[model samples]
Target: MSNELSVDNLVTGYGKQEIVHDISVSARPGQITCIFGPNGSGKSTVVKAIAGLLPAWSGRITLGNTELTGLPVHAMVRNGIVMMPQGGGVFPRFTVMENLRMGGYALDNKQVVEDRIEALIADYPNLQRRRNTAAGSLSGGEQMMVAIARALVTDPEFVMLDEPSAGLSPALVHETMERVVSLKERGVGVIMVEQNIREALPVADSVYIFAGGKRKFAGTQKDIRDDNHLMSIYMGGD
Candidate 1:
């Protein structure tokens, strides 16, 4: 199976207003693909469209041979596609362990769910240590960890994250980005929508830059870094 998530000629928006236009991007297993742009550039809209939270007006979204164009959120999860939204994804009132359990709610086998939770806890010692704490009580980085760990309980093939570094401390941002890199190491395709370009570029294998609801540049980290003009545009410089 070719573990590649491809988005072809996608167009979507809210109400009668269109935001994304003919956007095509792809993420391969064991690599990170980042989508970044100025505010109102439709980066998050594209993510939502691919995640099935927002319907696409026109496009084809495929993971390997599976078509994911119109699948609902639950159906997308069952197909090994999980999206963790910005801020935090945990149930604030729930305990850390409970939140993790909720992530595997689609699974029928209780034992399998428990086993996955155990594996996640073992891999993330902080989760094991704070298993009893409410998700709302943890630090921003810890909460993000729980969110990502929760997504892993289902063993998703493609994981999409939005603005993970927002409001995190410098150290926490580094830790969070490291965890994102670990996802690639585990052979899962990662699609990230980030405004933290400095932190995100190092981990990205490919990048797509959007402006005014259109893609302005699509290339590697080196391509973006070496181009002074692109950097000027990206940094809002004259």
Candidate 2:
């Protein structure tokens, strides 16, 4: 099976108000696909639709050959697609270990879930040290770590992060982006919705720029770099 997630001409929004209009993008395993734009450009809406949180008004979302347009969130997890919403989306009252285990709730085997949690905690020493501590008690950066680790417990082929840098300090933003890039190194395709153009540009293998609910550009990193006009308009260039 192909390890690619494709969204073709997706149009979705809350209630009857359309926020995204005919936008399409794709991501491959081991690549970082950054969906970038300023606030209110509908970046998060697209991510939500792809993650099955919002139903597409008109489009097809597929994982390789498998149709995923209308599947529930849990169904998407089983399809190897996991989404980490903005603000880390951790269960504050749950312990760090418990949060990670929740990521694997769709799996039928408890042993598999426990084993994955153990491996993730071992890999992230901070999580290992605070395994029993409530996730809400950890620092912002640490909570982001928990969220990423929890998303990984499912061993997803595609991980979609909604503004992983939001509300983080400059240092923590850098740290979070580093962790996002690491997912590509692990052969997991990463679709990150970000407003920080500078931070997302460096790590993005493929780029999609949205404005007013429309995709203005979709190309490789080098293509985006070479477009001086686009840079001036979006990146505050000369």
Candidate 3:
């Protein structure tokens, strides 16, 4: 598959301490390509650079045909790349509906934004049930649903989520993973950072493991499953 987003010779870090070494990666259209590794493995840092949350020390990041390196977060969003950082970024004091409205600000077409919000609520019924509730009142998993929905309000083509399943219960985690799988059916490209390798592997079209600031492995999910021993060596035994 070709790439919707591509990064070449990428290097980034904070205050002179490089966290990501020269790395090349790609996310193909209509697929879930995941980044997995233990903490501080440069997964989030590389993602932040791609999402325009951090400055790229060196490298090229291209989304579609446009260059994204050194662009601000808003610029990235304008390019149809929206990121939902870890913690969901929900507004504690705001109602679910209000939050959705804020997310749709970029859409000047009121009917379109409303239609998108309704579609999201329909997809996640739990969110529909709590449409008028304050975001802080919802449980962690529910909050995650809201966050993803808010990101979708922009009608983004590429959505990058950081540690999406972090605080959810087992059932909620499964549901969230299912949602990731479903994104491609909606024609959205997803790049996610996940700690739960076992769950993510089943849905990923292709997977990439980042270790020591470099890509340790990149292949189809079936390829990894075919060689169980290979996964343990490359993925650190889950």
Candidate 4:
């Protein structure tokens, strides 16, 4: 497992404002690389830029051998880049199986898709039990499961999560993070933007702190634990 995804000197912004400026990042294969920052620090914006929701104003984002700095979202997906947005990127009206099927829409192999679905169900009982339930009716935790399962449907090489643990009970948050960890066990690169810094730190193999649209600090969890530097840079200062 080497660098599965890499971003270099990225410069991007919305209509009139640039949020990510001259930024770079990389997610090593089978590793959980987390981007942590206070709100408005352009973390999610980075995800958008990578997932092709926003065009890269400048710089290169290379995934494996693909230079995907400005590829459209659809093209990115076909290229093995998929995003699991926060708040559960589930369609409220669709059943679990329906949502999962949509994820593999790009796949022409019907048997492969069906096999994968059955395998995911065996691994995640939560999804298996609620296969027929409308996604909207599930609890926040259950919905999160559906979202992750759906994203896996595409057989993504790298899965970017935007606050996977955001709005759930503590128990549910733990469940969501655990699910994310499971993805890594299966050897998928995960880049996440999480607000729960404390909980994320434990699972994060590498932690990146962003401030003013640039990387303020970067290191492993042990390198930053209980250190005042994180709060000094990521607190109200920025």
Backbone N/Cα/C clashes per model: 0, 0, 0, 0
lDDT per residue for candidate 4 within 1-238, as digits (tens), equals 4547988989988997989878888888688999988888889999999999999989998987778877888888888888988877899999999888888887788788888888887878988998998899998878888888888887788899999887788998888889889989988889999999877888898888888888877788877746576797686353
What is the C-alpha RMSD, rounded to one decimal, of candidate 2?
A: 2.3
Q: Give the TM-score of each candidate.
A: 0.94, 0.94, 0.89, 0.94
- Model 3, residue 55: C-alpha shift (Å): 0.9
Error of 3 at 189 (Å): 0.7
Q: Per-residue lDDT for 188 in model 1?
A: 84
lDDT of 3 by residue, 1-238 (tens): 2348999989999998999999888888788988887777799998899888889899999976788889988788777888887868899999999988878876668899899999889988899999999999998878888988899898888889898888778898898887787777788899999988878878888788887777777787766655565556455544
> Global lDDT of each model?
0.88, 0.89, 0.84, 0.85
Poorest 10 consecutive residues of model 2 by lDDT? 229-238
The CA lDDT at 138 in model 4 is: 90
lDDT by residue (1-238, candidate 1, tens digit) is: 2478899999999999999989899888888999988999899999999889999899999988989999998888888888988965789999999999988987788799899999988988988999999999998888988998998888999899999888889898899899999998888889999998889989999988888788787889878656576666564443
Error of 2 at 99 (Å): 0.9
How far off is residue 226 in model 2, in Å? 6.4
Residue-level lDDT tens digits of model 2 in 1-238: 2478999999998999999999999999999999887777789999888888999999999989899999999999999999998978999999998899899998989899999899888989999999999999999989999999999998999999998888999999999989998888889999999877778788999988888788888887777545475565454232
Per-model root-mean-square deviation over C-alphas: 2.0, 2.3, 2.7, 1.7
